[model samples]
Target: MTTKNVNLVSHPLVQHKLSLMREKDRSIKGFRELLNEIGMLLCYEVTRDLPLEMVDIETPLQPMKAPQIAGKKLTFAPILRAGVGFLDGMLALVPSARVAHIGLYRDPETLQAVEYYFKAPHDLSDRTVVMMDPMLATGNSACAAASLLKARGARDIRFVCLLAAPEGIAHFQKEHSDVPIWTAAVDERLNDHGYILPGLGDAGDRMFGTK
Candidate 1:
């Protein structure tokens, strides 16, 4: 489903993997592997529109002009802990991309995002930033992360996730309408405690076996 600034990746592979991840009984290994696979696929979709420039090159048999991604290397900024799960796969596709880490945890009672750590390339203004977080449930963390990036000079930012809740999307867009979102699915709604209904549990816990 496409919305104003959201792109739902309806690819069959992505959907299938996401379904497996959503299964409550899924093994930790399976969940982590699936998240990695989906991360690679989503990375593909998110970077589809990146600009390219042609350069003269010599092939094995003949000379040619080859197109390569234009501009500075991209920065993959993953919200810490759970967001780290998407990193390996995304980096597998764009190995040279820089990495930025943002650490924010939701306050248990208030459900507001509280930041404890943040680090990124100094040239954020010169590179495209893709922020990865598997679940966009409350949008509190996502919005706060974006604000942090913008304050650090990042102008081009995109958000990628496995699943999102309607409330989260609304809250995110309302605050950072300029940043587009790409996700595998948009779940029905968030539960009372800010978890997405039918979401694949706590992403950090599931991925890290912390629960």
Candidate 2:
């Protein structure tokens, strides 16, 4: 069920959609739509263990007690700008969840992740933080982003991605063993350029057609 704390969303729909997205020449509309659909499904998988509490509610026929998510609400921290691709669909499922943005870019020559922007909810420490990034390749930015959130007082955190590479997961777990990861697939390896082998390509470019 858990591999190095990376939970793969293996539902049939997620599997099928991810396969479609991996095609060579998908349109922007198709890619974006499929990503959203997968995002929504991933939301279901990641938050499966959210704490719940009994609450009294009135049904159409009678009053009854129901269970609702309890204690801390959620905060979605998207590692931009590709992470933004998963934002809308995730929010669609958890409409009340707040969003945090962290902008980072990997340097071409050095492959170092550089932070360009950061904005997060003030009550991060009290909420469960779900960090979103479509691909986990080098794990440089993902680790840095997790550290940033911790420094800013975030205690409970998790990560979600569309596909993850073994090297990336190892690097990320080396830095953060407590924060669990969720992905649609655990890819085989990272290419020489720090890209996931057989990856759907640069997710941002695929979504926006910059490629």
TM-score of each predicted structure versus truth: 0.98, 0.96
Which tens-of-lDDT digit does each residue in 1-211 have in candidate 2? 2366879788999999999999988889999999988889999998999999999999999999999999877999999888988989999999999999999999989988999999998989999999999998999989999999998999999999999998889889989989999999988888899999899999988898888
- Local accuracy of candidate 1 as per-residue lDDT tens digits, 35-66: 99999999999999999999999999999999
Compare the candidates by TM-score and give the number of the best one: 1
Instruction: Report lDDT per candidate.
Output: 0.95, 0.92
| Model 2 residue 53 lDDT score | 99
Q: Candidate 1, 144: how far from true, in Å? A: 0.4
lDDT of 2 at 198: 92
Model 2 superposed RMSD (Cα): 1.5
Clashing pairs in 2: none
